[model samples]
Target: MTQQNKIRICVAGATGWAASALCKAIIKTPDIELVAAISRSNAGKNLSEVLSLDTEKNIPIFATVEEALQVPSDVFFEYTSPVIAKHHILSALRAQRQVIVGTSGLTDEDYASIEAAAHDSGRGVLAVGNFAISVVLLNRFAEMAARYMPHWEIIDYASDKKVDSPSGSTLELVSRLAKVGQPITTIPIQDTKGYPETRGAAINHTQVHSVRLPGYIVSLEAIFGMESEKLILRHEAGSSAEPYVNGALLAIRKVQLVKGFRRGLDSVMD
Candidate 1:
């Protein structure tokens, strides 16, 4: 492809684990150009310096998303925190740029607004909680099972430092599962006994439990119960961030062909 044909990409949270990995992938991909790296902490430094890549290419790092938008880019990749994910993505959409958001924590209402904005702006935003294909399949299968099974719960496992109670993947799974079936229990929360908190938060109609520990990288489990048997679907991730890279890249490429906000990596997988 010619220079003009390449996909120009800018990354928010360039210094983050997932964004840094994505930057390297963009650098190596022949069809994608890493145009800007946005990191407040390392704004003035070259991306190559911050990433410790051997390449001498001086990719300018911007401290803010507003500043980075001055340079044109086809896609804006977001790997930041939830605190700013909504603002960054909305800004990118208003700028008429396609976006891929890997950051989590936004509520369903936030996504509805984003979808409306994307529709008005005629841009696309693809957001996925866990980009690993396995997790995507796990979610899909659980959703399928939810059509038949009436009772299920989500268990999210992550490292202790993970701020979010239920990991993004678990939330995504629960949300999707909730859509397919009604809540298994009809009892009011006021009637529940002992520690109500132990029952976990309700997502859609399903209860989701979060477990954070030191050794765990991240894991999500969807447990379904029936009359005589129980079924469990789980996806676990190691310390490496490689699992997310491929799915994210796929979203970047697919977002160009989409309009409005889209959710789930499985949307593009098919």
Candidate 2:
């Protein structure tokens, strides 16, 4: 693309915590044009007003993704709530646009449909749980450790306000860990407080413990306990969403260069 014809980008869930942060970061990059912003609550408002950005940051906000599509865009960043994120992704795909999704809680059925749509549209779709660079590294390390340990589990942490348990992060972690080995059975049960369900859910045959509290942004740990010393590998998201911005932006800018559905933020990370 020439300097005059930079990539046109649309952001779904414009007013969200992450989307707002991404928009602020997008302002700094000249490689992309913020053509559309979607937020049901802030519909019809200027993007700046919706995100509480300065007047210098001029961008339009729309109520629906379809409305944003009225304009031309090369990529769409889908940050809508998890319940609706897949729908937004599918819609964007049907429009033959690449999508970078940060939302979680997608059902397996939605993934199947998304994979098919990506194949049919010949466009790229990238999704990840936590987009921070460190989280990507954590996943990478976990994958390596799995090759050696072969027996371990996952623990996902979030603020009490966070609703999803066994978060998308855990799913991503477990799925990627499966590339080496996601233990094919629940983590051994030693102490149960009269309720085995408190141990959280199981995915890919690995135990995933979800902890919700008011102390953190988001975090995940890969625990491998063998003979004596236990290995605890973790990635903690600090108090800001800035870390996710770069990863999402990189995926968005590269979406046009890829085809089919790609999973994980690590694809763009070292």
Candidate 2 lDDT over residue span 1-270, tens digit each: 465677888999878888889887776677877878898887887897667664465677888778888878888888877777877888888898888878878766777899899999888888787778888888888887777776787888889998777677787888787677557343355455577887667676787888888896788889986666678998888888888888877777776777887778877554
| CA lDDT, every model vs. true structure | 0.86, 0.80
C-alpha positional error of residue 27 in candidate 2 after TM-score superposition, expressed in Å: 1.3
Question: What TM-score, to 2 decimals, does candidate 2 have?
Answer: 0.91
Give me the candidate number with maximum lDDT.
Answer: 1
Candidate 1 residue pairs that clash: none
Q: Top TM-score: which candidate number?
A: 1
TM-scores of all candidate predictions against the true structure: 0.96, 0.91
Q: Report how far off residue 270 is in candidate 1 (Å).
A: 2.9
Q: What lDDT would candidate 2 get against the real structure?
A: 0.80
Q: State the weakest 10-residue window (summed lDDT) of model 2.
A: 184-193
